[model samples]
Target: MLGLGAPELILIILAILLLFGYKKLPDASRSLGRSLRIFKGEMKGMKDDDVRSKDPARTTPVRGEIVAPADPAAELEAEARAAELRAAELRAQAERSRTADGPR
Candidate 1:
């Protein structure tokens, strides 16, 4: 497409074949096809969800009188806790890796 003619395309394909080898190309292609299919399916699902959200009747009705609107302070506090947990997990992972690598 990007100013690439048939010869350029052929050259690129040949290069890829050389890099990956013919024996593995089919498996790689299958994996790529499956990834594309999954991507398309997720995109379609998001679009359907968007459409459903736009229709009021599609959503569940509130069970009772709505409480006061959500507090931003509480949300921020929850987010901060989640971030701390993630950081702790990452630190643990790094420690494990360092131990496994054995004083390198």
Candidate 2:
């Protein structure tokens, strides 16, 4: 699509085939297709969010306490912190139980 002609396309395809071999091509193609689908979906979601944010009713009230946006990165970071806290609690509980069991 970036101005590459048929010969260039053929050469690129040949390079990919040589690098990954025939057997792995299908799996690689499926993976690429899935990635493209996910990318498209996320792009559409962002576009929709942009549309919604332009409307006054859809946005958070400015005077009230600031509401957190639905950010995936922040959610993942919070989940990771929760998991770490849970792990630490479990380790402490295990240590307490071992000590209570008296040196087995």
Candidate 3:
């Protein structure tokens, strides 16, 4: 719709046909149609959902700094530290077992 007319559309289609050949055009068109249908359905659903949700308080904007979610990096570092501690404990237990099993 953005300044595109029938002639421009025809030219564009011909360009695509030249690029992808005739055999693949049907599959490409089918995929494009499905995507457009899905996009249209999603937009309609969002519009309906917006209409059904009309609470004034919900619409009101918060006037403070939004707190960010917990850092994933910190969580990963904590998990790594816990794993290292567990490994150290296992090594210490193994050392004790080896010492006890050795000849006096």
Candidate 4:
């Protein structure tokens, strides 16, 4: 591949062997093989996900009902409740500080 003939490939391998030595070559090759396999598997999974996403009938929810917007009144009520909780916490903190300061 990439214009590398058999002679060139052999030369490259010999150079790598000389550089890394015989002891580390097997470990390097095994790590390279594992990385390549993981890369290939991830690419395959991404392609499958792409195909599934493109097919609306396969990826879309079966119920097919559109969600309605949240009620503004309900949201406002929730905010008011949160504010009340914060106020209660602040009062409790003030009471604790007053007690700690001993009648100050």
Candidate 5:
């Protein structure tokens, strides 16, 4: 609908036909249609899930061990410490390797 007229549409169609030969066009269109159908189905399922989530009675209760509340700052600090440890370990390994390879 980008203000394209019949002639422009025809030209575009011709270009597509030229790009993808007629024999393959049908298969491509079929694949595209199937993808679109699957996408629509997924979108519908997501919307249904959202609706179910909004309705407490329709939602499933947690069955496993309850998870603790997230602590963003503490989690980040822990991750940073782990990364620092890994970096130190790598540096030590590299230093050992370099010393072993020295004068060789």
Candidate 6:
């Protein structure tokens, strides 16, 4: 991908690993994954909205009107999961800072 050969890709991967270090890599990856998931969901929702707009029976809401999610329980669960991820990230960050401070 991106015109990078195997060796070049390996070198780039190694550079990223060294830059971030092994300890923080997982956290970075987890955040990236969450971001990708959110983006993917948004894209899917946009496509669904496009399809809905094309339908003759469905009326679009007026501007400034609130839109509720199709599944409120699922929305709440996703929010709870996000909060958990944020909390975990904060704890990891605090631990990293504490270790880096070292006997001060």
How close to the true structure is residue 74 of candidate 5, measured as C-alpha lDDT? 97
Question: Against the true structure, whose TM-score is highest?
Answer: 5
The per-model lDDT (C-alpha) reads: 0.91, 0.93, 0.87, 0.90, 0.92, 0.92
lDDT tens digits, residues 1-104, model 6?
38989899899999999999999999999999999999999999999989989996565768997767678999999999999999999999999999999977
lDDT of 5 by residue, 1-104 (tens): 48999999999999999999999999999999999999999999999999999997666758984655468889999999999999999999999999999966
The collision pairs in model 5 are none
At residue 38, give the lDDT of candidate 2: 100
Using lDDT as the measure, name the better of candidate 1 and candidate 6: 6
Q: What is the full ranking by lDDT, best candidate first?
A: 2, 6, 5, 1, 4, 3
Which ten contiguous residues of candidate 1 have the minimum total lDDT? 60-69
TM-score of each: 0.56, 0.52, 0.43, 0.49, 0.58, 0.55
Cα deviation in Å at residue 6, candidate 2? Answer: 3.4
Residue 18 CA error for candidate 3 (Å)?
1.2
The 10-residue segment of model 2 with minimum total lDDT is 60-69
- lDDT per residue for candidate 3 within 31-57, as digits (tens), equals 999999999999999987786668653
Whole-structure CA lDDT of model 6: 0.92
> Where is model 5 poorest over a 10-residue stretch in terms of lDDT?
61-70
Expressed as tens digits, the lDDT of each residue in 11-70 for candidate 2 is 999999999999999999999999999999999999989998999768766796677766
TM-score of 2: 0.52
Which ranges of candidate 6 are over 4 A from the true structure?
Answer: 61-104
